[model samples]
Target: MDTTTYPAPQHRTATTTAPPPRGPAATFALHLGAMAVAMLLGMLLLAPVATALADAAGWDQAAAGPEAEALVMAATMTLGMAVWMVHRGHGPRAVGEMTAAMVLPFAMGLAPYWAGLVSAADALVVGHVLMLPAMVGAMLLRRSEYTGGHAHIRARTAWGRAVEAVAHRWPTLLALGLTFDSWLRPGIPPAWTLLLLGAEYLVIGAVRREFHRDRLLAAHIAGFVLYLGLAAVAATTPATVAGPVIAAAWILHIAWDAALHRADRVTWRWYAEACAVIDLVVGVTVLLAL
Candidate 1:
């Protein structure tokens, strides 16, 4: 009787940990596909409308340019919708990023007209008016896709951080002075002047590890060489004194980038601002030279 009453020992079962949830890749893909479909449908619908409008406006129905323009508008509308979808999560930062990205495509599309590869009518109607809208719309809609991931994606190394800081903190007044002086007094051949200036900055950037050093160097060198070549073609070559001025200006610009990049503590912003400022200065100088 005692042996029969003995209780058996209970065994405990081990619990396994559940796996982590996956990212929203499937949802994102679905949204992107929907956007594409919407864009196509919009294009199809808008083409007829655009044709009708052109006819009403007395634009040549026989002209391929106007028809292409119509298609661009339709596509652009769809693109705008897509942008809205993509940027659903992103804020102003996405807008700025998209705007920057659009620059290259816009330039490329316009090159046909600028380089005489396409007729003015086609360039204006299709490239600028139609294509631009679609591109912009698409950019805006896709902003959501970028979300909050850009910062993580753009994380920099120690060297990159140091260079950015220097650029941000660069002396603005000094740079401005140097730039102005170069334009006021033209002396050296533009090519040599630019090379000297660019080399000086290139060394500084390399040492500092400034943000976008390659682009900065290329821009400076290209700008200088092109300016000099153009100046040579033009009978109005600046005196040798002008060479120093141009070099000074180039140095100033590089310094400004170094300081500015360091000041902001963010390489991307610093790089963008520096580029914009440099481009402005270059444009102004070129106009003045002309």
Candidate 2:
């Protein structure tokens, strides 16, 4: 055997050539069409879904008034745009800018309404109209990225992967939380609402067939008893006591969500994560009575 050690030959590395730019005009038209679809979904499809969910959940979406309704509409539009953009293989930064553009007009309009400077109707109309220009501005900010015809589906870093996961999987849960966060502002939750918690716990556990596990069984029974006790307290006690009790229950449920999440036992991790966030929102809303 030859004793001389030769250095290993370097392998040829392949280089990726980016595709030609789509040009601003093509990019703008594509985004404009996306906006149109988003607008259509917001007004005609998703808004009604939010309203129906609110109705079914005894949330009384109207009681949140016009500003909240406008925000919900904005959120729905953002959701539609986000889903469509991801489906179109757009990059996260570009998608984020588009989402911000969709929501900014609503936020701007809401400010004047909150300050009593503008009527809700005018604010809403202005917000809707302003959204188009805001979107144009966002596209301008990412001119190169948006106008480029190169594949937008670049390899993601760990942070980018995490962001894309949230942007894709968690929007609906966030929207649902927004839709119902106002539920506690009016008064104590309805009797059915409190009872529903118990049912929800049982169903969530049963679906996993995890009730056969001793620890899970004990946990579910404890949760049922706690919910039942809360329902009783809410029914018989004064609002002063009931509100805090209900709020505490909601906050406590976050712990339940955590346990299930860590064990990866009951529901999908996304549901657990989203439920924790929603629970915290409702809990704080009840505590503040806002």
In terms of TM-score, the best-performing candidate is 2
How high is each candidate's TM-score? 0.28, 0.50
lDDT tens string, model 1, 1-290? 56667678864333222222334455444544544554454445445555556677887755654335534554544444334433233234453444343333444455677777876566544433544454446544654442223221221466544433433333332234224443554333344544443354445555666636566566656655654554344324454445445544544555545554566532444353545455346545654554
Clash count for candidate 1 is 43
Model 2 deviation from the true structure expressed as Cα RMSD, one decimal place:
10.9
Tell me the lDDT of candidate 1. 0.46
Q: Which candidate is the best by lDDT?
A: 2
